[model samples]
Target: MEEVSTKPSGYKEYVAGLLAGVATVIVGHPFDTVKVKLQKHSTEVEGIKYRNGLHCTVRILATERVRRLYKGATSSFIGVAFESSLVFGIYSHTKNGPQPQVIIPSAAFGGAIISFVLCPSELVKHACNKAELLQCRMQVQGADLIVTGMFPGGSTALLRESVGNAVFFSLNTDSSDPHNLTDVGIGILTGGLGGVAFWSAVLPLDVAKTVIQTAPDKSCQRNPFQIYRRTGVRGCYAGLGPTIVRAFPANAAAIVTWKLAMKLLGIKNE
Candidate 1:
């Protein structure tokens, strides 16, 4: 078992989180492409029909080849990098309070905080989603407001993130005591489960967020409930298949990378 020699406290979480975000984007972007496709068009009666995540993956590979699946990868990489760093950093930082007690609340607080961050990044990512290949999503946290109109799906983002983070952190692990998690394997399992819980809880909100953010026209209906009424219950979970599948590996890889990065940086998870 590899042990992290240096247990320095302060900036390590953000650094480790940075690495974790990179891993997440690399491992999960293809699935995410499938997910976004499904979210955007799965409910449609006429158009490219993606029966499921696998079908979508196959179709994209067949038509556009692998590159098509990673169309927005560049922008996704940058946005996810900042979003993920803040996710772990803020959540972990707030978790400094009494263990177990503050875990979920801290996660929610962190989620709420980063909701502001992710809204614009996500907007840019999705706004240019169907546009030219690999649009520059380098709009940092602050510049996003003016660059992208006032966040289109701000409320939905907040709901998904706050609730999602609470569920994700709660299931992540009982890691308050290091002894509880035997090793990295356990951490990976718990972390993956956490990710699953997060998506499962908030996927509907995600579907709404995607639709709202990617709306071509502002006059288009913005209400999630209205969408649900129009599309029905099944439509709300349009991309559930890909999201569930991506949840495990993407987040498992993230947790493992986070731990490994911490080891390399001479620190430990907060």
Candidate 2:
């Protein structure tokens, strides 16, 4: 069996997280696309864009090509690469550093850094996912669009990241503790559960972010509470089922891949 390293450098953590980001994007992007579509669909419409996750996925596959499901994948790749690198890098650094008790705070700080990468990427990705933009080959305002689009969701993203990261790192740390259990199985289980906890905690914020990001009209970009008022509780959680489903295997794979990559790079958990 491979031994966990007690001391992993920042570079190794970044690289491992980069690999994990790739794995996570490959597994989770399609589901995310569906989630966004569901979130952005108008609740006041006569016929819903999608009834649920399964229906949404099927409709997309049937009407659009398989590639449509991966519309924003490139942007997502870029975002996740930087975001995960910083997150895991900071997380490992703080966890292995002199003051290790501040794991939650370390993760929260990383989450804040993540917004800078995620904001622009999400803008491009969401724009690319739009039918009008796709038909126009994404001929839209460049920097101006990104700037305007990201502004509305900045606070929501911060809250989502801070809370979500705290949940993920804390749960993962408990699960991977040496005294608790043996083998990678624990990591997988804990990682999956961590994903669930993170997403569940941040789903409302995510709903608001999706609304602001994908809104066709600037007027539709409302505050989170405004969105809650308009859409109500059920609408805010429109895609919760699919998100949780995607969270499990996607995060499990990401965590396992990160550990394996770190092992290959000669970094082990202490």
TM-score of each: 0.74, 0.74
Q: Tens-digit lDDT track for model 2 on 138-172?
A: 34544555446455577888888988998888777
How many residue pairs collide in each prediction? 0, 4
Could you tell me which 10 consecutive residues in candidate 1 have the lowest summed lDDT? 132-141
Q: Candidate 2, residue 270: CA error in Å?
A: 5.0
Model 1, residue 35: C-alpha shift (Å): 5.4
Q: Which lDDT value does model 1 have at 229?
A: 88
Q: Write the per-residue lDDT of candidate 1 for residues 1-270, one digit (tens) a residue.
A: 666543336777788788889999898899878887877776755668788778888988998999998886987788887788888877766675435678888888889989998887777666565653223222333455475565878988998999998888777644333333466777778778888989888988888888887765567688888878888878888867667899998988787777677667655454
CA lDDT, every model vs. true structure = 0.76, 0.77
The TM-score obtained by model 2 is: 0.74
Report the number of backbone clashes for model 1: 0
